[model samples]
Structures are given as C-alpha cells and as structure tokens.
Target: MAQGKLERTGFWPGDARLVISISMQFEAGAQPERGASGPFPPLDPKYPDLPMQTWYDYGVKEGIPRMLDLWDRVGVKVTSHMVGQAVDRHPQLAREIVERGHEAAGHGQTWEPQFSMTPAQERAGYLASIASIERATGTRPIGFNAFWLRGTPNTLGILQELGFVYHIDDISRDEPFTVPVNGKPFMVVPYTLRNNDIVRYDSPALTVDAYLADLKAEFDLLYQEAGRRRRMMSISTHDRISGTPARVRALETFIRYAQSHPGVRFMRKDEIARFALTAPGVPRS
Candidate 1:
C-alpha cells in the first residue's frame, strides 16, 4: 500500500506546534482469564485464575473512574477504546464516557487476536463490536483499534466496507495519513508503543519520575519537529495499567508539562483524522 504524507509546509489546526493524541484502553472484563499478563504465568485453562481476573476487574471498578477524574481535572478529552463485552457489562460507564465528551472507539468484541480469523469472521467481529458500542454509548464509533495492534491482509477492506473512517493499528508515521482500501480512502492514525503505559509501567515497571521524564522528552522533540511540518505525539494508557494513583499522577504531570508549551494541543484521534483528511497539503490517496 502507498502511504500518504503531508507537504513539508503543512500545519495542524491553528498551526499548533504539536498535537498530542491520548488513547485510554477500556478492556477489563472483555479479556479471557487464561492469557492475562501479570507477574506470574497464568494458571492452566482448566482452573479459573480468580486473582488475575480481579486484577483486570480493578480497571472497571477503580482504574477507569480515577482516570476519568484526572482528565476532568486537566480539562483534556481522550478517546476510550471500549471492548464490546466490557461495554455490554457496564453500559452505564460506556454511556458516561460519551456524556463526558470523550470519543468512544471500538477495540473488538473481546480482547482477542483477530489476525488468524477468516475474513468473514473478522467482519462479523468488527460488526458486533460496532453494534455493542453504539447500543451502549448511543454513538457508533468510526475509529477502530485491533487487539494487540494486529491485523490481517483483509483488515482495511473490511473496515472500509463497514463504514469506518480510520484505524489505529498502524505505527508507521508520526502524523495521520490515508491509504486506499478497495479504491476508497481510509485513514490511519498511527499508535505508539514507546509512549504506551503497558510497555513502560506494566512490564518493565519504570519509576513514576522516569515515566514522566520520558513523556516530556518525547513531547520536546516532537514539538521541535512540528515547527517544520505537522507532528503528532501518541500517548497510550490502559485502565488496568496507568490508572493507578502514582501512574496517573505521572500522566497528569506530563500533560501539564506539555500544556506549558506555547502551541501544544491535546486532540482525540478521530479529530486528528478528520483534520488531516481536509488539511491543505495532505495527500488523500
């Protein structure tokens, strides 16, 4: 596929120096009990990992609420990638996300891989996820993020046929770009693993200060690069990972640090995709 690029002179809305897109994952109850990541290996499939299951449950009971409060305090909106089964189990929380003025994007029916599925099964999975988010939030999601950021050859075409405007599985660029999916335009707002909470806090377990420093460093470089052309910084957080008090504090500090700059704006991924599609000098092939 031919990837689109913006002209060197292009700028974001209002000519902002840097646009920060924040993604908050909401996939607590949707994952299978046997494959969860924790300090120890998961138990055999024959036995239920009750402790591990509750670890994810914390995301629903405490993590999400904490993150929501932090965003409210900072006056920044984010995109919450809601899994279908999780939304169905907690429709009120799903509705509350939209009510609070954040975008609800599909993250699949369950936190399972889709790359190995047949094309028909993948299509059905996408459809079911979209329907679940729509039913719970009263707003259909136009953006999708596959579980584990994996996609098959048929992923883009299926998404376009299902009327999705964009997907976040691509990590090839720092800014939004479009590619042809069955001869129609589909947007790819790239996601990042470098700035992901799961990678930093959950696995390697970086210190709060270290995590904050990394975020600021990333923003600093991108802010400088944006002076020449459009640049976007993607920061990812999970309900079960970055929602803890210490990690959330680090995230809030990083946000404030970025805000102190002259021309850094936090935007939702959908907003970024739409702006890129219409922005001058952005290729739309």
Candidate 2:
C-alpha cells in the first residue's frame, strides 16, 4: 500500500542490481534449555541438560567446519551473529570467522529476550557482549541482531553510544535504510524469516526440496524487482540448523543458484551499514 521510489545516485558498489547478505547465528552456549510443558516455558533449570547442550555444540564443531569449507569454496563473506558466551567459550571460533574475512556481529550475551529488560540491564548485557567479542575476535562488533529480533526501547540509543553502525533486527524493508538517532545515522539492514531454514521446524512443508524451491522463488522475484532499482536480500542461516549435514546441501544449492545469476553480490552486513550512509533516499539527519 505504501508506494514509493528511492531517488539516488547509485545502488551499490560496481553498480550491482542486488546485494545478498548471508547471516549465520552462532548460538552454541546461548540457547535456553527445554522448560516445563506449561503455557509459559519456565526458565527454572533443575538440571544440566547435557544432551540438548551437545546438540548446540554440533554447530561449533562439525557444523561450523562444514560451513566454513563450503563458504570458502564458494567465496562469500558472511555475518556471524555470535553469542558472547559462545565466543568466550570458543575464542578460536570467532577468530576463525574473522580470519576468514567475515563480519562478527553481536547476537546477545546469552540467547534471551531483551524486550522485557530494563534499560540498565540491557546496557550491561550489550556491553558485556561487546567486550567478549572484542576479546575473542580482536575487533568490536559493529552490527547487532538481538535474540528473536527483540530489542528494548533504548536499544538504538545504546547501540549509538556503543559505536555500532547498524541494526538488523528490523525486517520491515527489503533494502538497507537509515534511521536518525540524536542526529547520528543508525543503519538498518533488514533480515527475513520467511526464507529462513527455521521454517522447516514448524512449517507445513516437510521436505528440504520444498524449502530450496521456495528460497529460489523468493530470490527470483527479488532479483526481477531489483532490475528497476537496487535491492537487497537478507538470508538468515543458523549453524545448528543449516549447518547440519542434511540441510547444508540445500543451502549450498541456494548459494550456487544465486551465484549463477548476474548482478548479484554477496556482502557482509557491516558492508551494508557503511554503504547505507551514502545510499539514495536514506534519511539524512
């Protein structure tokens, strides 16, 4: 219903029509345990559920290695939204992501909802996460995607104060945009869950082929639209889900399919943030 046009000098580097960003959520130590089978899942952990925790570990060990190899072979830069605790636990994991030329963004200190927290608690948690990332990866995180895309009212202000360049929790737009925070620019790199692999967990479709087809279809339509002007596609991936042996093949398939087309560039989220500053039609505050 909102019809518009984005007047600008150019769309992207090299005048590409579409920008593709692949984000992998690295939440090895941040996922909460299975709670009681009640209306609201209680976080009262009575015991250490080693099995569930090990399932997440698979992402760090087997899944991450596979993903690294595949992405390296395909020559793509990704944004890894890693939990601070996970980075603390496996410092080398974050190091590997950075050494391989990928962006490491802050997911959370622990994978918990931030919408209910006080501003002070949220600030403390984010600061802790930033410090952990710096310690492990040698560079502070510049982008953020809170758990479940939830952020407090002061989240944007906090990010600005902490020197972040962008936020990806907002999925309102298909292309990158900017927001004015106290006269400073806060870039928003929108993320999508419709094309995400998490759909396989609860959606009606039961097969990987179906998932792959849907992803291709979405890309095809977006690519078509981008021809009129520049557009961006944010594909959300999870090391624990897409990194699994069975699902990773489909992911690689999608990557290869997207690469086969012209006018497509795979970028890191940080790159999007920096480019958005100069992008056409973005707010200048």
Best by TM-score: 1
Clashing pairs in 2: none
Residues 37-150 of candidate 2: C-alpha lDDT, one tens digit per residue? 211324458865556666687789888878888889899999999899889988998899999999999987976678998888889999999999999989999999987788
Alpha-carbon deviation at 99 in model 2, angstroms: 0.5
What are the lDDT figures for the candidates, one per model? 0.87, 0.82
Ten-residue segment with the worst summed lDDT in candidate 1?
1-10
What does candidate 1's lDDT look like per residue over 1-285, in tens digits? 234433243387876778999999999888786766765576888877788988888898999999999999999999999999999998999999889989999898977798898999999899999999999989989899987899899998988888889999988888888988887778989999999988776556578899889888888888877876778999999988888999899988999988999888899988998888778766664
The TM-score, computed over Cα atoms with residue i paired to residue i, of candidate 2 is: 0.90
Candidates' TM-scores? 0.94, 0.90
TM-score of 1: 0.94
The runs of at least 3 residues in candidate 2 whose Cα sits more than 4 Å from the true structure, single-residue gaps closed, are: 1-9, 33-45, 283-285
